[model samples]
Target chain A: MNMMTGVSPWERLIRPDRVHGSLYTDPDIFEAELKNIWYRTWVYVGHESEVPNANDYVVKSIGPQSVIMTRDEQGKVNLLLNRCSHRGNQVCSFERGSARSFTCPFHSWTFANDGRLVGYAFPDGYEGQDKAQLALGRVTRVESYRGFVFGSFAADGPTLREHLGGAAETIDRLVRTSPEGEVEITAGFLKHRVKANWKFILENECDGYHPAFVHTSIFGVADSMIGKLYGGASTALTRDYGNGHTEIDLRPEFRKRDAPMSWFGTSEERLPDYTARMKAAYGDTAAREIMIDGTPHVMIFPNLFIAEIQMFVIQPLGVDDSVQHVTALQFKGAPDLNRRLRQQTMGSVGPAGFLLADDSEMYERCHRGVLARNPEWIFLGRGEKRQRQDELGFTVGHVTDEVPSRGIWTHYRNLMEPI
Target chain B: MLSRESSATLMSAITAFLYREARLQDEHQYEAWEKLWTDDGVYWVPANGADIDPERQMSIIYDNRSRIALRVRQLMTGKHFTQTPQSNLRRLISNIELMDEQPDDGDIAVASNSLIFESSLRDDTLWAARNEYRLRYVDGELRMASKKVILVNNDKAIYTLSFLV
Candidate 1:
């Protein structure tokens, strides 16, 4: 392997068809990721529904940076760094809440929900210190599309829309499945930790080849029920939607099979009621199409992933540990539909879910496997030398192909390389 | 309130029921464990806090009798990958007492604190929880109408909780 003379260690780690094992195990490489990918890219924060009211706020993260996503007095969403200007203690410690102002427990320096310095306890202690200048520090930039908010540490780069690129349709299609065209986060979230690199989860999210083998116990028991509806594992449409995003859609045959893919229940029990509800909201044709649409597992690059009715954020805690916070998105007007979605969400990905538990073990096993000294390179050449561009300009491939993994590594290498 | 002798007898009966339940799971007697539940039984492990409605909020594990049958079936099939190296577990149950009763049903609500030791592969995880059992003493049989586990570490991220807790 010839190393490019001027390339740094991180840049040299990535290859076209395979990546070095150190990329997943080295703590030094984790630091490089923070600088190259986390700080440089636009990271998703929270959804608009989370902060619908004027004072509502939720603490989020952009890489290692803690940020507060709040709706201000004038009804505009603000992404403010959680650090207190005076001595830097986190002002908002709770996960999510609604309040007019944030007060630092360390010194009681207060800032409004919009990140403006409201007041301070010892005002006279600083005679010439400008209160306005002492306001809460915010991330470099914050932007949103359709209700999903995002932030970046850099002052300038590609806008969120441009960064989303071909993946915007994925997000749009997700929220559009709602009858009211809006989705709300369920009452709470389910969080679980996996001892592995975060990218492993990202890769597993789009890979269609692993599940039937990994979750064979769960799926095997329900083979008759699942096999009838899903048709077969090979029929899914797996493709890369550019900018490192990917989707593996397996429900395209729902209508053709007369099955409602959205429901985990059998088609006979769900279609009559579920289809009728859709028809009432969107009329017969659109309703039928929407019900039949395969609920794809869409991975928006670095972290955000949505599958079925659940949305989750993967927070990287350390080199070997990452936390996944999952929220079941509920329909605005459909109570029964929301309940079913909740059931499916718990059944699939929640902490004690039938599926996520399997994936977590696999990820830990992958991390542990790479601990071996030999086998320096992890082969990723499942389906190579074949790719296509969809109308939306996303790179497309076979459902079982490793094209998504290749796309991720390619974008990852480009992002990590120093300019 | 029952007499002191009556209360002690009731406590012993419930304690034996709880211990037998744990042993059934430890020995992989899932079918035997399944038979301990009532037809309308609910098995819930609430997240964030206790008494949370599974239909209204997210849960770590929430299943009615039928769903519980499905989960148990999967575990028994030797296919759940997380359980590939099946967990070795023992529950230390303590602080058994009767909880506040529901007015309508002839069910006794039993509460206890437990420290469950689960080890698989090279990892040993200590799982702590407040176990609340809604048992109906039907025809001299103790049936699990509901079991709610409020894990002390429920708010934190957990890995491979494949075995029943």
Candidate 2:
């Protein structure tokens, strides 16, 4: 047998069937994940609508590396390392603003929006030096789909579209909800850190099983409010879309049947004159389709998540910690009252939201439990006995099952191992 | 013009109210705090320090009574996973000032500087906020119309603030 055989550390730590506890508590494994998965995959940076004009920039991170995504004077978006080429000083320290060029504070080295070396404070000492070879390092790949921008540190990975696969439809639906065919990242963001494994969040988001039990308080409140308003019972519906994507449909079911789309109050109670307003704005069917669909939440793998009413981005800070940044999106031509309603709803679902407070608390509890004794693995066998596949190559389970979380971990484990 | 005695009394009332609120929060007297707000009171924790508009700038916490009650219920629930290792907080409120009053709305705008020392099992956090309280007398009681908190480190990346700030 080989010297590094059956009892090897790698084999014992990670296997096709189970993952070791060290994956959650070990710093070394965390570092490897940062380098291999976060740096290699297409990580979401920001949205094009965030920097609508030339020279607008936003700061974000991929792993531990700080990066600035900017719209150049030529209207092309570029993602550049925030570090200065000389002495590794941070090039753009501001969180976000409109600037033609960023000047390093340490040595006064300046870089344009496209990350070109524009000017230097003092040129006497560097007369003979090669300035062309010393430009701000650019990201390997910077791509955008439906106005959402993403950057990858690796050069040889699959194209952004290929990486997204069947997930692009969700993005399309998000943008399509607006008659303008685009969405912008709204001003202001809710930034908070959760003391839990980053993967736990991604797994829990589409996990429909946790709501009925984990969010009993939310359901109670919803029952009181929803019952009073609609005189119906609220139901949480979970559907598994192929390619590691899932959707959670939360709609009130009345009279022992899924309430018709009209009862949810799209055109009747919420917007009594919605049809007339739509005709005055975008015509007839356009308004009906955009306003009526009831799907609320969508998740794009590796860290981009969206709710029809809210937008959020999750960035891994450490092995056992992650930062969740939330923004509320608004239609460009949406009325002030509609925008305020959206903002109120978004705030109710944000970090301080009734639902999120419980979710975050649960994440902390999970983190505490995982750090407990010498357990080799955490079980993901909720629906293993009934793992059924559909047309999309995805598995389905009961509304309150851990099937989606299991799928997330399965994909995560696959991406973690070397190909 | 108001007499110096009246002004001092008003200041004392404002300072006492602020201290009482902090004490209630530290003691987890959430239900009592809920009673201090008007029916339509808004609690806002601005994401940017100098933001003038809550509509345009993001806030850390913006909740009304209903949402605040919901949060209280969740915290009391056994399934609130994040609160497993419950967080303990101590707040220091000082530099109280009665800035201005709107005669038309009968609203008194009071500003105070505050520092909160929060401790979880693994981390200790320090937060400094400039708080503005818009108070109005309703039915002979001083009730808050809006409470706005602007943190000094507003624009910086932050950890989860799972409680009222």
Best by lDDT: 1
Candidate 2 lDDT, tens digit per residue, A116-209? Answer: 8878877888888888788898889999998888888898978989877767767776665454656766656777677877777777777666
Clashes of each: 0, 7
Cα lDDT of model 1 by residue, A294-316, tens digit: 35478887888887678888888
Q: What is the lDDT of residue B150 in candidate 2?
A: 84
Write candidate 1's Cα lDDT for B78-158 as tens digits: 878788878888888889888767536678888999888988763888889999889997778999999999999787677
The C-alpha TM-scores of every prediction are: 0.94, 0.88
First chain TM-score in every candidate? 0.93, 0.86
Model 1, C-alpha of A70: deviation from truth (Å): 1.2
Q: List where candidate 2 sits over 4 angstroms from the true fold.
A: A1-3, A6-18, A224-268, A272-290, A336-341, B65-86, B100-104
**Model 1: CA > 4 A from native:** A1-11, A224-233, A258-277, B100-103
> Which residue pairs come into collision in candidate 1?
none
TM-score of chain B of each: 0.93, 0.89
Local error of candidate 2 at residue B109 (angstroms):
1.8
**How far off is residue B101 in model 2, in Å?**
6.1
On the 0 to 100 scale, the lDDT of residue A168 in model 1 is 87
lDDT of 2 by residue, B17-42 (tens): 89999988776676787778888888
